[model samples]
Target: METPPQRNANMAQIFHRSTNFISRFSLFAGIFLAGLALTGVLGLARSPYFTRQNVTRSQPVQFSHKHHVGDDGIDCRYCHTSVETSATAGIPQTKTCMSCHSVLFNNVGYLEPIRESYRTDASIEWVKVHRLADYVYFNHSIHVSKGVGCSTCHGRVDQMPLMFQANTLLMQWCLDCHRNTEMALRPLDKVYDMAWRPAANQAEIGRQYKAERNIRNTSELSSCSTCHR
Candidate 1:
């Protein structure tokens, strides 16, 4: 049988080479797939849908911040009266709305809810858009008093027709400001000015304010207990 056509020595080498190639290829493919999965997860986490940024919820009354704050030039503290004095910025009560609407848009259909709530002396359960975990003990009064403008955290509420969560409000988000608070700081008098802009020498001014206020360093601001109580 022609000595069974003796198998070539190269056959073993070829088989080994093929197996090694497959092993390396598989390792690379696994790594690529794992990388893709990780990237996708991170992208989803930061997306608007996940962060609830600009997502408007249905409110009992479609109170437009754009109209009230932007058009009418109403100060933020006008409605959020407790922002500077309390840990939580208290929502405007029914009477608070009627204080203006009852005279301004009293006949408007949208103001009906306000009138009803006022007539009944019932509280309007306004849906909270920005909410942090209970474990996070945030003090609004402290932040407001520290020269941090409302727009720093709430974004341009004057432009938002329906209030939405402007910032991610994540721990990292809070730390970003706490670590470099100078960027967000404004004059105490301008805290309620939603359209407030920094001066040309804002950095220098911010440093001055930081020194004057004796603000804590990044190490303390980023500490676990800073937000987590």
Candidate 2:
């Protein structure tokens, strides 16, 4: 009355015994490769080729911050006039260079560009070393007023034979300072001092300066609009 269902000889196993292991190994290998690819992309993004850190830029005139700030002890404000009062650190006009070079090295062969620019009332095409993305908005005055020194972001310019990007200038780098800003504060008088260092009690001093200056909190400083807008 009951005919037992007979297995068909042609019906073979759809999967091999090793199929499970192969499937699992394939999944793991794909995941590992994906992770490796992501890591490589992230590393490349932060590398000097992308960030331009420590890479010296060629300039129209071979101006040396070392000679100006180190050898001659010239102040930063002499060239960057608007640093204290404006969003931009204003580039020095040809006249500013003429103020010194007119007498100091007026006849020098290399000084001809300065003379030509001044004579023609045209600006010297000085290549900018520190450049932020166009979408980023940075103010020199605000940072200076808060006791953030020039060398804090610019590095030891007095020691550089040619100006280069000392830091990565990445969003993460800015966020690091914004998150722990007190550590970067100094006396207002020392804002331009390239060699200024914190004393043994700098932590205490920085907190005091932070309070006195009423610097914004980390949340505000690190907010998207702070730099982006």
Best by TM-score: 2
Instruction: Name the runs in model 1 displaced over 4 angstroms.
Output: 1-20
Worst 10 residues of 2 by lDDT: 3-12
Worst 10 residues of 1 by lDDT: 5-14
Candidate 1 local lDDT, 150-217, one digit each (tens) = 88889999999998999998777898888887887888899888889888888889888888888888
RMSD to native for every prediction? 3.9, 3.2
- Which residue pairs in candidate 2 collide? none
If candidate 1 were superposed on the true structure by all CA atoms, what would the RMSD be?
A: 3.9
lDDT of 1 at 86: 95
Q: What TM-score would you give candidate 2 relative to the actual structure? A: 0.89
CA displacement after TM-score superposition, residue 116 of candidate 1 (Å): 2.0
